[model samples]
Target: MEEMAIVFSPKYYEHNTGRDHPESSRRLKTVMRELKRLNLFSATTGCQLVEPELASIENLELVHDPEYVGLVKRICELGGGLLDLGDTVVSPKSFEVARYAVGGARKAVDSVLDGNYQKAFALVRPPGHHAGPYYGAGFCVFNNVAVAAAYLIEQHSFERVLILDVDAHHGNGTQEIFYDSEKALYMSLHEDPREFPGTGFVDEVGEGAGLGYNVNVPLPFGTGDEEYMKAFDEVVVPVARQYEPQFVLVSVGYDSHYGDPVGKLQLSAAAYESIFKKTLDLASTVCQGRLVAVLEGGYNLGQLGKLAALTISRMADFSYSMKDGTPPANSNVARRARRVIEKVEKAHSAFWKLRA
Candidate 1:
């Protein structure tokens, strides 16, 4: 077994939305091609490729409504149509492919927990962060990360799980699912929700026992790597250190890259490497290096492959960098980011030590 595992399946492509859809089969294909170009597929690469199983309906129900689960299947069976108002589309095999995506995430989690790999990345998609218990939106079918986290808490007896969503869009489904559960801590650094799915605000901290556990750092458009790293240093790193979770899961999305077609942020490919390095270090310190990352969104086919390969290289402890030098910081976004940090600190100080 390799030190890092990659869970994937070609079945993921069967969920075809359309040629023009940003979330197309070509995303995974590009990623796979780059991994090959980077020689990441060689037998000596120290990475293992694992196929994903189909997630059980029982497992799906852990984070989705049973009725909703049936509805997805029923809709697909009836020759598949739009899953929601528009963002999510379903083909005949989409239901099965989505289940496999969820299963891929679980496999990654299980691999880390079983000590077979220090970390794993699920390269499957139909990104789940936007899918909620009652509805699927933003190209998501089921809340894949949520299902994996709930599995850890309910089945494996793991108490503390930290979900770090670095997607361009807020993980609205993830936040809503764990909004009241202290067992899971949901943190997201997303494009301001005013853009889409519109929910991850500074004040939308968790409720009930989960109060202060949910953190959102909503950045304005044109925010670049520096601003994102600042948020990580001030908020993500500190909070992860304080939380000291038993396991860490990253909702990796490269859509924030400047080259992405759908997103408006200005992150460069290097931003992902920087973020992964920090997250990997955090996992080492707080969770014995047990970590798993799931693919969320990154529309630019050209950048996705390289960025995904770079992320896998980081997970495997290899050195690599993308030459797409990140653009200079947006000073205006920087000022606003500081304010957001202060607001988050005040909201969360009641629960965590904000300063060293």
Candidate 2:
């Protein structure tokens, strides 16, 4: 088996969101270029680049409403229009491309579960996580990660799956999709809703049978490596250990980086490395490294490729590094993050045993 599998396709670039939109083909272009420049596909790296098939309507209906699926297709068929009132642009080819993106995510999961690779990363586009059951928002046309998680439970008969979302923004759509399913535990660390916007508050835990299965850590603005690592050590790690999922999925988003123009948080490159390392270690311990990471968000064109390449290199166990200059040290942000962490721990105290 290879060390890692990367699911990608040149077709991902066919979904055009306009030249000035933050969610553009340029992001993947840069990432693929960087991956090549760093020789990540060399024989020494033990990484394979795999193309993905288009996700069938049956696969989409696993999580989304069938009517919504048809609606998207019809819209794209009529040329191009916005899926949501804001930002989410779609061209004539977008519906096909979006299906391909979901297919890429599912392919990653299959690659890992089939023992073809120890781990996999689906580097697809039109970033999901913000798209919900019937609506698409936040430059997202479909909820890729959610569909993959649902696919695991419905198609593979998996009982326990964990989705760790490290996007700077909360995965509201993902949380919504699995909000009442105990089989999928959704955890997210994002900038405070007050700073950004949308859901992911501390009290919005799961409901019904899925109660306490949803976890959110809304850090303060300017939150950096120290705060993120602390939350990972204290909250994310403990909850995940108790959940003991059969597989792990990460909604990996680099928008939290300080260099990202679209994201407001202050995370550095080292912080991202630590985040990936912790997730890998957790997966290794609980699920025998059955992990697949799907790209979500990150808008800084200049740094997007470098960060993505670094992540892939790390997955391949190859040495590649990029520094984010000096890490930010803000005592105020630290204090706020501590409060948020405390609140999250307290909120979920009844669900899992947390470290004091």
Candidate 3:
């Protein structure tokens, strides 16, 4: 088994959202270029680039409504249009490409579960977290990580899957999908929802059996590495340990980086590295290193690829570094982040043992 596997396909580039669009083929192109420049596929890195198969309709229906799945297919077949109101543009080939993206995510999970790799990262495009059971939005066409988690439970008969979303925007769709179930715990750390998709507030914890399973840490704008790491240490790590997930999945989004144009939070590449390393350690502690990360957001073409490559290197335990300027310290932002973390801890205290 390789140390890590990267699920990607050149075909992901065919899903054209538009040349000028933030979620364009250029993003993947840049990421691939950086991966190659770093020699990530070399044996020394113990990483292999694996192409993904198209996801079957049955697999898609595991999470999404059949009608919604068919709608996306039909829309793409009819020469592609917007999957959502405006941002989620699709082309004639987008349906297939989106399936390939989902396929890539699933492939990553399978690779880790099969013991072929300790961990895997699905570097496909057309991000998925914004899409839900019946709709796609925010440049997302399908909930790739959601489907992967559902697949692990339904197909593999595994329970207790944990999804850790570090996207700058809340994965409202992923949360909604699993909001009523205990099989999957959805935790997200993102900018305040008032600034983005307008959801994932601290009080919007899960319902029914999943009442305490949904964890959201909505930070203030200008939050940097220190605040983010503190949230991970105080809130994320404790909740995750209590859940004791059988497998871990991360919605890896780099838009929170200080360089990203789409997101408002200020996170340095080093912050992302620390987050990834912490996630890897968390998985190793709870799930024997069974983890898979799927691409969700990150629009800055110049920095997206470098961050993606850095994440892959971290997964492979390969040493690679890049500096994308630091975010200035803001004591005010740190205080706000602490408040949010405290609220989140209080909100979920009934569900998990958050404090000693």
Candidate 4:
């Protein structure tokens, strides 16, 4: 009955990632602040506030390996040492909160797929993407979006799906999970390999049967609206049209916004609005308005909040506008990224029906 459902739980704070970690509970706190400041909190109407359900191992095994899932459970159960080399730490309650994260995503997917909502956003933390089918990285515990996407495919009987990631860091896990399937297309536009976790290269473009289906647009540092749009126009839109998925999901991370300390690009609220609007256009064309966005990394709360509100407003199809004044364009990255994307366009044109 709600237009949108935003899922969150205070229990996500239990992960206890230790001091000075960028991917802390503080990030979600800021997102919560922004949502409240924008008045998305009223559970009475408009947006729905739903309790997060724990994602069963069955759902998790959709994107993660059974052995890896077992290991994570064992580590959380044993809970005396770090579950990861670093960035990801576990406590006695970690499995609960981590499950909440994945469960929240599933709930969102279910709500959307079941006709309970037009669209939904999962604001749970311990971001996924750096997580892989068998591993975790970049503060992610489990591939939350991956599990939920797989759920949509298996439980909902969907034929085609699109995973769009705008995270500053690449969505390595989502990419790995959906890499070889034409039924699922994973696309990411992120900072170059110069950044950490270092994947998302122009050439990664999925392997084997997924060849050319996986699109990675790696932008350089200081990329602004112009560059972002260029990537969208040249790569994202063109390839996506060919695939024409039944459902669309975005890995929405705010770190690419200007002044995110950990970020390399200089995207602003306006750029985000543009991207969201473009996504809306595509969703309207392909998925019958069935789209979902999950929270990824965005450490700067202020920027994140503005972008979040702007994103929701656009998703709700309100008249879109934003604050102005962007720095000069990073045309160099734009041009270089285009060359790579053009190759993708050529390689995958048969599947996606690229413009000649």
Q: Which candidate is the best by lDDT?
A: 2
In model 1, the runs with Cα more than 4 Å from the true position are none
TM-score of each: 0.97, 0.98, 0.98, 0.92
Off by over 4 Å in 2: 195-197
Which pairs in model 2 have colliding backbones?
none
Which residue pairs does candidate 3 place in steric collision?
A: none
Candidate 4, which ten residues in sequence have the lowest lDDT sum? 316-325
Q: Write the per-residue lDDT of candidate 1 for residues 1-356, one digit (tens) a residue.
A: 23888999989989889779899999999998888777886677678888888999999999999999999999999998887887699888899999999999999999888888888999998889999999999999998999999999999998899999999999999999999998999999988898688899989989999998899988888888887888889888998898899999999989899988888789988788889989989988988889999999999987899899889888897766778976777788888877777887787778878742
Question: How many clashing pairs per prediction, in order?
Answer: 0, 0, 0, 1
Q: State the displacement of the C-alpha of residue 235, model 3, in Å, after optimal TM-score superposition.
A: 0.7
Total residue pair clashes for candidate 3: 0
Residue pairs in candidate 4 whose N, alpha carbon or C atoms collide under 3 angstroms: 242-352
Q: Rank the candidates by lDDT, best first.
A: 2, 3, 1, 4
TM-score-wise, the better of 2 and 4 is 2
Model 1: colliding residue pairs: none
lDDT of each: 0.89, 0.90, 0.90, 0.79
- Work out how many backbone clashes candidate 4 has: 1
Which whole-number lDDT from 0 to 100 does residue 50 have in model 4? 72
Model 3 poorest ten-residue lDDT run: 347-356
Once fitted onto the true fold, the runs of candidate 3 whose alpha carbons sit more than 4 angstroms away are none
Higher-TM-score candidate of 1 and 4: 1
Report the C-alpha lDDT of model 3 over 105-199, residue by residue, as the tens digit: 99999988888889889998889998999999999998999999999999998889999999999999999999999999999999988956889
